[model samples]
Target: MLDFTCGRAIAVARNEKLQPELLKVGELASRAGVTVRALHHYDRIGLLKPSARAASGYRLYDRADVARLHQVQALRRFGLPLAEIGVVLDQPDTRFAGIVAEQITALRRQIAQASALRGQLVQLQRQLQLGAEPDLANWLSTLELMGAYDSYFTKEELQRLPFFQFDSQRDGIWGRLVARIAALMAGGVPAASRQARHLALHWMRRLERDTAANPDFAIRMGALMEGEPSARQRIGITPELKQYVIDALAENRLRIYANYLDADELRRMREHGGKHGKQWMTLIAAVHQQMHAGAAPGDPAVQALTREWFALFRQGAGDNPATLAKMRLAIDSEPALLAGSWINAEMLAFIRQSAATLQAPR
Candidate 1:
């Protein structure tokens, strides 16, 4: 048998606008479905201070206290610590919407981590079920290997990684691009060839879009590839292809009025490259130079380059519909660009109009 007394008391408290003059600690706790000690702790922390104290020093909660307690419980569900909850609730300017947004982000990260762990566990289970001598040694080694790769990214960085969905209508254009690049590397294709230069341009454009969407994209990518010698070795990007990308980027850098490595810097870079597997270093240097070029502020050439890039993105709509949609949304949503240039209202309005036209049903 369950007592209806607490429910009735809460109903009364909820329905009535009047602040209760006094509430027995036990009764309040029963109505709130929490321990009396929990209520006491809330009061002690100045989170839910009672409206009044009786002669016997008993706590008496009011309507304001009930509201504050409700907020505390909601924040608790977000996994916020008691101390942090207090800070959040006490903040005068923090809106409920902001708190909700933060909680949503945290929930997404927790879900992603849980999903990764579940996948790993399922793999281990399958191995055991196969009657393969489930070597605890190998299992531990595998976990360590995974941890090393995962540790390169912070939780936030991992969340920001680009996720492109395959569209059947496009016939898996992105997958084809990946395969083409892999094949080019495998076939020892010259980087400076027309095909190789086109591929390099594709890669750079993709990278630029990614970096524009996620300011931390480059940082996270660098971290992920850091110290992963096997990964670079397996890719086997040839010297010719690397030089091709370097040359293409150098041309683009000049076009955008952006500086590439100076003679001394290039010499030092090449020297450093020679010491530590020059091929990967060269590719990385080319990408970095392109980034530097794109980073220049307030140059008319840079603005023209941006417009040209956007034009290229518009053309991509027919070739890669899913990517085009995403790019359109990002261009429309992102508030600013590389340097502090506010995306002008006229530009945004034009984008919206163009997007609508592009999205219209045939």
Candidate 2:
């Protein structure tokens, strides 16, 4: 009986040893394109276990273990969350197609949100280039404003908007120039003075660079700015600052043009430029176009723009200074004279600078 029992035990041992060789956990992960940590997690959760253990006691797996890993990865790729994946792993035949469809839907939503975020960054980059120096706090807060735009535009659409179209370097320069103007204004600077007009002239050159003489975008952006007071405020666009800029630009324009006119002609211009101001508005738009197109100071296109502007001024002044000088005096004395105009200081400043070469010798 003892011999028979021992013989039976030896047979059992031989059968166990003859079983196919298994792979170590590291080897299995390498072959499967998965991490060893993942294998351990699966083992701990009783998900995929090694088929055996080597004599050295390391975990070992067989071909069946590899098949299980593939299933897990497939389900994951289909967008199955880990928790739900556990349940579906047991019955993949019923869940595979359904899970993949669900995952695709979720991925689309995530892509949309990411796209919106990307649009905001592009817009912000443009703003920064345009001369926005947002603080760290307001910088992030500005991104929150993206939600407001989502209702009206997609990321690609946002990039095409006027607010995002300025040349980035010039836009940045605009911010610094605005600071200088604001400082001068705050210190009681007088726009009629040569010093202030020079500052205004500096500002105009940058404005021309930013707008590239394109007013449509500038107009669109201005409307948005007026509509979004909070955004404007954060960027330092105060009414006082705006008014100061306007005053400075007008004064600078007058000074630069004064070089080309006599006292009588200047007097006539002031009257007509204000009286047929609607025509002046047309000239203003034309000037923007010239600036946007980067016409030379003496470009014929620019000459045509000035001719139109001069004609409007000549209309009211009777082709001479006449009552225009008094009109100027009145306009200068009252801030209210500037209140209802669409013209901005930045625009005037730009024209003043660009028209510099047209000035007659002193």
Candidate 3:
């Protein structure tokens, strides 16, 4: 009888060993991508209690317990509160289908949000490819400002905008330049002072480099700053700074003209420039647009622009050959003068070629 009882006990032990496997809390937490503490919390809350306890008083999780834990995590990710998750799990019936539908809707929303985020990242990547080199802080700030940019620019325009083309070297230079100007202002330096004039020329050159490919960029940027207070604050260009820069630029121009113009010529050029400044701005914008679009100098559109350009140039230079020659020399010799006018040698060559084509015998 003793032998038979021992044999039955051994058989029972073998059968228990052949049963389904169970996992300790640590093992289950690792497998489910949750923390052991989180599992303990779930157990304490009766949300995902283990199915069995070992003789050593340790909690052990069976397959069903793991499946329930997965459900709880899924509901949590769907933004369901733990209390609500337990209630939802308890009512695993036709109502469960409704819950699943809600989860699907939530997942769809998450996917759409993720896609939009991905699109912004792609846009930033393109900006980087185009020569923007923002560091971590600036990169995060740029991401934050992407939505703000949408209110002011179209997607295509944003793609072409060089607003984000700020490398550390240029950023450092700009910071120093602004600081120097602020110092001059604080020290009571007149805008017409040589020091201010020099800094103003530097400012114009930097702005020209930023907006050279698109003349309308400067106008739109002004509009953006005027319309968006946050943008002004972010860029650190207050209204006072803007006016100071403008005054300094005017002085810089005066100095340039004085080098090449008599009193009478200066008076005439100033009048002509003021009278037709808007028209000149319009023409320059058109020429830049055409150039950016790859329009050849001989294109009919370019020929028309060339005609308008020469007409405006003659007016602004006082329609005198010698004055025109002097103005041309000033422009050619002075980088600051070119920056002020938003015209480069390449643009001039394009316009000149178009003028030659226009003057060619038909």
Candidate 4:
């Protein structure tokens, strides 16, 4: 009877060992791309357990253990805490596809946020290169503001915007411009001042120069100015700046025709006061002249002008001078207009108005 009982025990042990043949612990770990030590640790923590041990004392896992390891690895890849991973793996009816889908969604969101952060960092880097003192706190605050309007902007739009940077001399000139503009707005100076108009002309020319060099100018400028409505409001530029820019743009169109129009062609074209034609033509001409001259858009004059305009747009409110300078550099490197075409008047007008509104006096 004792011999018969022993024979039965041996048979039972052999059957148990054979049952786990599909997944040895090492093979399971290897399949899951994890270390064997990791599998052991999971077993020690009760997160996963092998079904049996062989005669050689090697751990043997079944299909269920292999599945559990897959889930744990997937969750870890998604940045879940190990504790949470354990809880998820322990659930009796956890749907693998559902869990994977949820993780994928989470990863997508994280990737988008990281992309935005990288964009913001690039702006900061540009500012630093231009010798601007960028404020981390303000940058963070700006990012928060941007998040509020995330839906209003596409990823492409957000990526194209510029940040402000500071330069002492340029900042000083910008301060003066802002003060002058604010005083005018307060005292009701006409938007079409000889000085103000000249300022506007200077701004347009400078912008043309900068954008000619930096094709990304419009996008970066949009990003810097549009993210904070409160910043615009603080500068007292609620409505007038938009109208002011509109008028200035009209004036610029006139100036372009006056300076560049062919005499007989001008008469044939009914160019009364050289107004109401394409606005971007003037910008194109300006850019063309600069290219012909082989001038760098980030020239000191351009930087000073950008600083002044940024300050003026803020209506004496502070901005990141360095960021603006960097943006100017970028603009100088790539012209907004393509080789055979300039930006459309409507688009230019819209961008100009929007930028003005964003930078309106506070």
The top-ranked prediction according to lDDT is: 3
Query: Residue-wise lDDT of candidate 4 within 1-362, one digit each (tens)?
Result: 01112221211134453331355666665556779998888889888888777666677665566666768877888798878888876678878998778777767656766765776687789999999998776666655555544544455444333222222344355446556666666787776566666665554544444344343453333343465664443333334664564465445443343343345433432333224223334444444344446545455433333344444323321244543343334333443212223344433333334345455321
Model 4 worst lDDT run, 10 consecutive residues: 1-10
TM-scores for candidates 1 onward, in order: 0.42, 0.41, 0.54, 0.32
How good is model 1 by TM-score?
0.42
lDDT of 1 by residue, 1-362 (tens): 12333443321243333333346678778867889999988888787788776555667676667767767876898789999999988889857766567777777767766765776576678887997666675556545544555666555555555421112323245446556866766687765456765676666656545444443455444444455544333333344444555554443322222123335433433333223223323333333343445543234443443444344433423334444454344444543221211124453444344334444321
lDDT of each: 0.52, 0.59, 0.73, 0.51
Which regions of candidate 3 fall more than 4 Å away from where they truly are?
A: 1-146, 156-162, 165-172, 271-279, 360-362
lDDT of prediction 2: 0.59
Better of 2 and 3 by lDDT: 3
Clash count, predicted structure 1: 1
2 or 4, greater by TM-score: 2
lDDT of 3 by residue, 1-362 (tens): 01112221111122234234567677667767889999999989999998876656667776678767767877888788999999889874725456567778767656755765675577679878989774575555545565677877776676456564434566578778888988998899999899998888888778767654566876676677777666765566788887788778776786798899998888876666646655776788899989989999999899988888887777766667788878878877877776666778999888888878878311
Ranking by TM-score: 3, 1, 2, 4
Off by over 4 Å in 2: 1-141, 144-172, 271-362
Model 2 Cα lDDT, one tens digit per residue, 97-136: 6655766766765675676567658877887898976467
Given candidate 2, what's the lDDT at residue 219?
Answer: 48
Better of 1 and 4 by TM-score: 1
Score residue 248 of candidate 2 by CA lDDT: 70
